[model samples]
Target: MSEEEHQHPTSHYVKIWAILLVLLAVSVTGPMLEIQWVTLLTAFGIAGVKAYMVAVKFMHIDQTPRFVTYLVTTTLVFMLLFFAGTAPDVMKDHGTNWEKPAWIAAEAAYAAGEVSHEPEHH
Candidate 1:
């Protein structure tokens, strides 16, 4: 690739940096704003923008081959799928639902006094 194709002006980098910093500030203060959906949306949205900037500017993903772009998109899709599949368990209240076999076993052991409430010494 020519130097011209590979090189970005300092001003471009500065602009992207400034945008990322503003997004970072928004993400940091999002939770304190006391709106759960707004906080989550802002955090995730800003994170996506930051990731896109890093990929396009730092990693040069936008100049990459079409196959490479497809590969990256596929990887991101799979990651979203993995997170979605596990989100229910992560968000669920384990204390209220002891349906898992491990939880049931632990409860049984506690009832039988096989599991001690006190801490063990070395």
Candidate 2:
């Protein structure tokens, strides 16, 4: 029908916006703590929450037909598969008939403490 027919009160969307903002702040600040597990958790966890909120409240995806939900789920699954299939190749330092000498040099320098690209923990 119309926006008013499907939408919640203004305060409801505003509250969701405020929650998303707070989550954004948490995700941005979380990595600064430099704990690997905490960083991963906060990054992915807050991101998933924010994505769901935007989908349900702003996009009104939940109001759509059940088939739409299945479509979205399938799309996300394919995306995950695509990423998983490519990530190992992308992360490799060398590949068939190709090498990254400059990156290797940079890594060597960082390891030797000659070039300080990585932030020192103090």
Output the number of the TM-score-best candidate: 2
Model 1: per-residue Cα lDDT over 86-105, one tens digit each: 88786553645455677767
Q: Write the per-residue lDDT of candidate 2 for residues 1-122, one digit (tens) a residue.
A: 78677768889889999999999999999999999998998999999999988987888787787899899889999999999999888877789988788878878887998887656631
Ten-residue region with minimum lDDT total, candidate 1: 90-99
Alpha-carbon TM-score of each model against the true structure = 0.64, 0.81
C-alpha-based local distance difference test score of model 1:
0.83
In model 2, which residue pairs have backbone atoms overlapping below 3 Å? none
| Alpha carbon deviation, residue 6, candidate 1 (Å) | 3.9
